[model samples]
Target: MNFNRKQYTEDDLLALYRGILLPRLIEERMLILLRQGRITKWFSGIGQEAISVGATLALNPDEYILPLHRNLGVFTGRNIPLDRLFAQFQGKTTGFTKGRDRSFHFGSKEHHIVGMISHLGPQLAVADGIALADLLDRKQKATLVFSGDGGASEGDFHEALNVAAVWGLPVIFMIENNGYGLSTPNSEQFKFASFIDKGPAYGIDTLQIDGNNVLEVYDTVRQAAASIRQNPRPILIEAMTFRMRGHEEASGTKYVPQELFEKWVKKDPVENFEKYLLDEMVLTSRSQVAIREELKSLIEEGLDKAFAVPMPEPNVAEELADMYRPFAPALITPTSPNTTEKRFVDAISDGLRQSLEHYPELVIMGQDIAEYGGVFKVTEGFVEQFGKQRIRNTPLCESAIVGIGLGMSVKEKKSVIEMQFADFVTSAFNQVVNNLAKSHYRWGQNADVVIRMPTGAGTAAGPFHSQSNEAWFFHTPGLKIVYPSSPYDAKGLLNAAIADPNPVLYFEHKLLYRSVASQIPDEYYTLEIGKAKLVTEGDDISIITYGMGVHWATRLLQTMPEVSADILDLRTLLPWDQEAVAQTVKKTGRVLILHEDTLTGGIGAEISAWISENCFNYLDGPVIRVASLDTAVPFSPPLEQQFLPVQRLQEKVAQLLKY
Candidate 1:
């Protein structure tokens, strides 16, 4: 984004510089502690100080901050107690991290700094999501996320940017481009374009700034943040900087050349800015020496106090979980919908209605989810019952939609995010892959959240609309994936997803929502994640599948009436029921695996691998497999029909029967 010349006052620069020095002093003291066997370990963001200090200066204390590992400057500058902060590094109970995560990964909710996330990309998307919530609630809080140059290259980075750009949510994406991306440089990360140059492709405004320039970095960030708040969309700021240290404390930084290290040391913001202050006569040599001494004293005082504080007694974790449980409406129960025959749409509608009724905090968001009744009417008439405050229909920005939901989840605890179509979910891929999947792993934070995607191929929607994306999330950690073949399981799993401590990526087979039915109870119920259902029992062979493929396998079983075939439908993808599958494989002695997802790297591959490793000895014959041809599910009715899993069913079944 273009900006007029803006500069900070001399005093403002000194204060920011002082903020930098305090964090460095703390980091250095912690290193000494680690070497002295006085602390477990510490990861200091030594060389990376300017952006952390400067970025904080750009936003107000009320504005939200999502910081990464090297965020001592930002956290300390924002007024997180130096002693409490250092205590956390020492693994004491009084430490900011509560002794849960490693040092340098805690958050101050009071300072409007959200909890620290261990994994990358999750916080970036959460920052975007929080900004969306503030906009919806008519508040003025904008969000900023600080990441290293390495995280920008991950798939989640692109996904988060795409969503932010499309929706124009008020969020800033700051990349601390410190030369190397953990051994890979910018050249290898993006061969097509520079990091900032690529932002426009996603309709985002981007800036490449000198990270070491305290004034330039602060002024540029302030401008970008202000612009985002006014216009509302994603902004990317690439701060060209260097790593004064290694990836982590244990990393000896052997990766950096001596020459580069020397060059960076000369340009260190602390030394250079101190010289600038002295040259301008803004502060005298006596004052500078005093400032240095102040830093040392401040650090020592912080450490002495932190070590004396108690560690979080074990019950802290349990207490946190208890706080998440709902009270009045202990579990979500359905409100009677007059409509009957149980269409998939009705099931989804009931689920929404019930969730809105039960949970005071439940939020529903998607494009055209309001008067338009959502693309498939799953959320039809929800806004009327729940009001716009609860059921939020948003602009068509899938990535941003998910990101916005993430932010809301952080602030409010639970939210339901519906991607218009499963295929369109690619628009918000970053929020799903990076943010949702990694949030808990990184920060010991939990998102009692629901992500609904209308997935699967059928009815000739073609390549764009007819797609199943569960396999993508299946590979990601910290995300629980649910794929239900029937209305009963769909509703059951959705309820469970909302109650889950971690984020749940729920895929609703677009075709099954209205067209399918099962004996769902009128009473409240919940299903456990990582549990597989044994649909049918047989002596001949076992058909292992989930979602639509379960129905297809059952259909194929009808053709082979002479052969007794058992079916195992895995409900959840991540942490799937390995023991059940191994048990089924042993019982049937023969197995045929299937899924509607594509063949290559599909969910089937995982099931197959699991069976190979654990169920291999029990197999009477080679584990037969059935899956859609490794091709983009074609849009044409006839071609799509041929392209799906039907063609492979007979072959796989025959092979399993023979075995």
Candidate 2:
């Protein structure tokens, strides 16, 4: 086949050939290592090298690329040192993630690469976030993200495409259709004949091509990136390809038919590209032999160096390090004389407004947060004050939005995302726990984002809208959970969460939006994140609670004038005030832990266990806990009221006082 060199020079074509050849040889070497037990696992990219190599070579060096497990060519095309990559595969400390993660499962910010999670489709949304950051900063950069045909069936895929189309972010969704997801064929994955048909449905430009052709991929991606730079928007490219080997080294290819392998072997990307280079006279037979031999030697040397490096010595300090950036939590004490009576919701709004002004680069995003002013109007006037760029509305894509926030944080941009309601956070559980919460610890990239969760059940919003789900995130180590009751603490805590160096879940009770009001300081202030407040001083017993539980304890105390008890509002649940809890436990010799969540596996359980373990001698009685029944929040107001811990708190407090 005669080649036309209109777009690329002979040198460029040879470079592309080298790129494809390098990964093919590397994967071949890795397979041999897998057999020899030198590496734990290997996701082979033998036949699909052209797609990763050509696509990566087509982009600007600064543009980000989120690669899949099979895109070893993406790393080589970016010129990542083979020695470091070998070390990463060998789990050495010199790797990108410092041996914290193995194989191709980790990202390198220095290389403008964000690695994919096993969930598959969240990286598409994270690419949109990087593109959005480039747009906001007026840097015309395009992001290339990869996924397989089976991964496109995920909800994150649909959400990412819709949001990227709506926002007109500069991103290229590269879908490699290898015909199977693990053992399942494409027939069982989706109903569409081609992913291109679904692109017009999302109003995104689409294209499809033979993924084995190296020059075609390079030319198409280069042109697509240029077009996106001229006018920023997302494009979907379906690369027709095949996986020639098993999903992983351990999983045999018994599921794949022999005829399918025969069909793809003839169309091998590396072999075909090399043939084209020879046909076009870009590579002579002698030169090709020399190149292959040189590459093999380089691979051997890299592997030897990687093998010589020592494995990581994991200690407690090393394990706990980089979970969060260093930032001292401070108590909120306003030096200004100006103070205003504000409702809980308004205090939160004021805090956001102040933060937008304080941090000019901060972005606030949520559903209906633009013109409609959010579901609860927390960002009512934000669009007018900060513009749509800073205060943005997103689609009903919980997972994508959270993943996007984490992606933006990867670029040093801080963000605040509102969940609308805390119950809906379940849709984004994986992104919160696996990606956003673990980003800092795994790769040393801090997810400096705050998620505002409007939680609690007093308004009768049903199971999907009203839920005190603080316990869900309290169990996550990399996250900071803060649930405030009063307006003063609400504003101060919100400020603290935004300024925090780690991912913070700020829970605002839905019932307290307008019902609770307090004298909030007019000046900007921040409260300590992991601190508790003593609302009342007493000696009979101690009540430890947060959010709506604080109000319940207060109401119970008002009703029973005879009982003198210490009311402690634990503003932060994860690092709940152990000192205050111990002091109160020793002072009263009896304690009660309260929350609106269910009794089992709730925050109250942790507090009770902690008191029992640390303050056993100080306790005159067993630590008592009052929480909601172990059932979904019922839609019936009567049932919900019965399910809540209001009456239970009254009964538990009296029992503890008597004890």
Candidate 3:
């Protein structure tokens, strides 16, 4: 094969040859370990190492690369220790993730690599966010993200491309078209002649090349990197290759035809690259044989060392807990006392303003968040003040945008993402529940992002717009859920959520935006997350509620002179104040859990269950729950009112008092 000597020297070609040889040798060793029951699984990149090595070498050392399971050559090209890779496969404590994750799901901050989850498509959006940070910092760095042909069929793939195109981010979306997505062939995946053909529709440059040829892949990526650094636009490259093995070591190649397997074997990237190096006189036959022997010895040594490493202790869970400990309250210089009264919407806006002024790395993004200042106007004038660099307006891709926030958070940039409506959060549910909430536990990385959700009912916005969806996230651990009912709490908790080191679901009631008002301090302060407020002290009964339900309970309490109920506003739902609830329940000897969310599987049920378990003897009556009927919010006023009837709440309270 002809090569470009100017683009790559003999030394570079030899290194690329080593890159191809190392992964193949390591896979053979790992397969031995798998058979010996020392390792659980193996995802080999036997015939596709050329693409990973070439692409990694094409970018700057400091540039980021998010690799999928099959890109082991990228790790080798980055000079990550072979023993560390073996340690991860063995689930030893010396692994990249400290034995928290297995297989190829590990990354290094020092190497500028973000570890990937099994859901392959979300990383593209995350790469976009990394590029956004580089652009904001005015740096000349680009991010390379790898995904399989099967992952391209996911919605996140298209959403990521759309966002990258619209923002003109410096990202390279590299697709490893290895002919098959697990057991499914590429013929059934899509109808496009080539994956690169779709790049034009997304306004991105495209390229398709022989992935087995190291020189060709390297030259193409090097040129693409130069253009991207100057122009800052996304590029799509589809590298044609083949997976020599099945998806994993255990998954045999029975589905693969013998002819196709044999054909790929003939064009094996490692063997072909070695032959090219020998043909070009870059390496002699003797040197090539020595290199293969050296790689085999190195693999054996790495496996030996990794086998001696200790497994993670059971107390490693405690270490994980310590790593994910709640962030302490932020210290702030109060400019003024609580002398200024403000509405809920103004309070939220002021909180955002304070956050932007305090944390320079704090970024706010959502649909119409930049120029339009969001649909609810909570972020009005923010783009003008903070500029579009920090305050970004994103495409209407909830999953991609949330994924962007997740990526930025992992890179140490705190992000606040707004979902125009709480209901729309369902679109990004996987990113939230799977990626954001489980990031720390899965890979020991914190997703320090706050997702602002405008929620609740009363505007008759119907099922789509009005929803009390806190229950959905409340069930998910590794996420903080905060729903403040008053302006003071809103301003304070929003600041807390932004400063928090964990992912927070900040639920802002849309109905209370204009209706609720309170005196809040002009200066910045963060309310303690997971703590409830004692709105009133009463000896009769305790009413635990959040969001708009707080107002309903308070108003109903005024009408019932015979029932003096202690109103407790649970500002943060996920880690609810058990001590506060216990004290209130002990003092009153009765409790009523109320919420605007539906009756089934509501947070009220959890609170009631806790009270029954912990304060059963203190209770004067059985714990009662008053919530909306188990149905979607209706469009009609009367039906909606009937669904969440105040009269039914009154009757429930009366009945509880009688009990």
| Index of the highest-lDDT prediction | 2
lDDT of 1 by residue, 122-152 (tens): 5676776777677666666568888777777
lDDT of 2 by residue, 1-659 (tens): 12345768888998898989999999889988888999999898778888899899999988899999999999988888889999999888898778878788788887888887888988888898888888899888899999999889999999999999999999999999999998899989888899999988999999997888888888899999999998999999999999888898688799998999999899988787788878878899999999999999999999888999999887788777667777786655779889999999999999999988878879999989988998899899888889999999998999999988987887789999999888888989999999888887777878888999988897877888878888888888899999898999999899989988799999998888999888889989998888899998889999998988888888888888888889999998877889988999999998998889999999989889988999999988889998999999998899999999887777777777676
| lDDT at 47, model 2 | 80
lDDT of 1: 0.75
Worst 10 residues of 3 by lDDT: 322-331
Model 2: lDDT of residue 405:
91
Off by over 4 Å in 1: 1-20, 24-51, 54-63, 68-71, 79-125, 134-288, 298-339, 393-396, 518-524, 612-618
Roughly what TM-score does model 3 have, to 2 decimal places?
0.97
Ranking by TM-score: 2, 3, 1
- Write out the backbone clash pairs for model 2: none
- Which residue pairs collide in model 3, if any? none
Query: What's every prediction's RMSD, in angstroms?
Result: 6.7, 1.5, 1.6
Question: How far is 513's C-alpha from truth in model 3 (Å)?
Answer: 0.6
Number of backbone collisions per candidate, in order?
22, 0, 0
